[model samples]
Target: MQELTTLKLIERISTLLRAEQRKKYSALGLQPVHIQTLDYLASCNRFSDTPAAVTDYLGLTKGTVSQTLQVLERKGYLEKQQDAADKRSVHLKILAPGQKLLKSITPFDVFIKAEQAIANKQFDSITAALYEALVALQNVNGTSSFGQCKNCITFSEENDHYYCLLMQQPLDQADIEKICREFISVTNSGLV
Candidate 1:
């Protein structure tokens, strides 16, 4: 059987999910990436690091990250500070309003509502089974196992699980421990 390329799958999913995200978050004048970025900052152990730190962690270009930061800052979602160790570097912290926004219409909540509606409307066991098949394929590709929860895009220390904000899936600690190059120190909730 021919393989379904990763790019093909990602393209298809992104096309659908992006539209959904726009319909929801666009009301708040936010793009899906904006939500992703804010949520990423809120969940970070040390978001008060240089902008380069965020770009590197997200595998995004510095220019793109800088542009997004500007938009976020203008919207009153973030505040920046000069790095103490490096005067030239700037760090970011999500403002209280930003944190509240993230905690409210989270991607997880969206997925749960959609999933519940789909389960209620039709025979969707096939869709569920196909997702299982996709997982099998991912495992075969040697890219499916959890490794490093701390570096995951959806990991939340408050929840203590690798919760994917995009997929809304909860990955076990062992499953995410392997892919955590961007791991930072875990901060207590009281600190925030």
Candidate 2:
């Protein structure tokens, strides 16, 4: 039998996880894209909560994302607020119901079992390896890293304040932990 490559293994794991996610969310009457949008909104900062960012992150058409957002809003899963500074832009905020739905639909049983089955060090190593692999793939595809602000090359902490050099904006702790569509991977930066 041919041995599985690392890429093949990663693909298999992704497929399995997605299958589990589908099974879990199907019971809640949500499709994968809807749940993915909710998950993204839950983890994204204010700067990344716009429909354009969602479209870019999901690699979906504007119409598709618009429909998804409408459905989510109608279901009371999210709300759209007009940006105070730019009426043309709108922000998507996941509601309490969406948060509750996310909590209920998280497919962590398999991952939890895998963690329990592996040593802490082994799990850490595996996670790091997977992250490295993901980075490589993203680089190859020239795709957005969608990493947390703290992991971006432009992130800085000075005078007890967090800031993003790229966006030229101050970041709070919450923003630092949230994902950004414009994230430039620090690992890919030219720093040793």
Best by TM-score: 2
Per-candidate RMSD vs. true structure?
Answer: 18.6, 18.7
For residues 78-131, write the lDDT of model 2, one tens digit per residue.
999999999998999999999999887675665655544333433235546565
Question: Alpha carbon lDDT of residue 192, candidate 1?
Answer: 17
Candidate 1 residue-wise lDDT, 149-184, digit = tens: 554445665556456554566767675544442322
Best by lDDT: 2
Pairs with steric clashes in candidate 2: none
TM-score of each: 0.53, 0.60
lDDT on C-alpha atoms for all candidate structures? 0.59, 0.77
Give the poorly placed runs of model 1, Cα more than 4 Å off: 1-11, 108-110, 114-192
Shift of residue 176 alpha carbon in model 1, Å: 39
- Cα deviation at 166, candidate 1, in Å, is 34
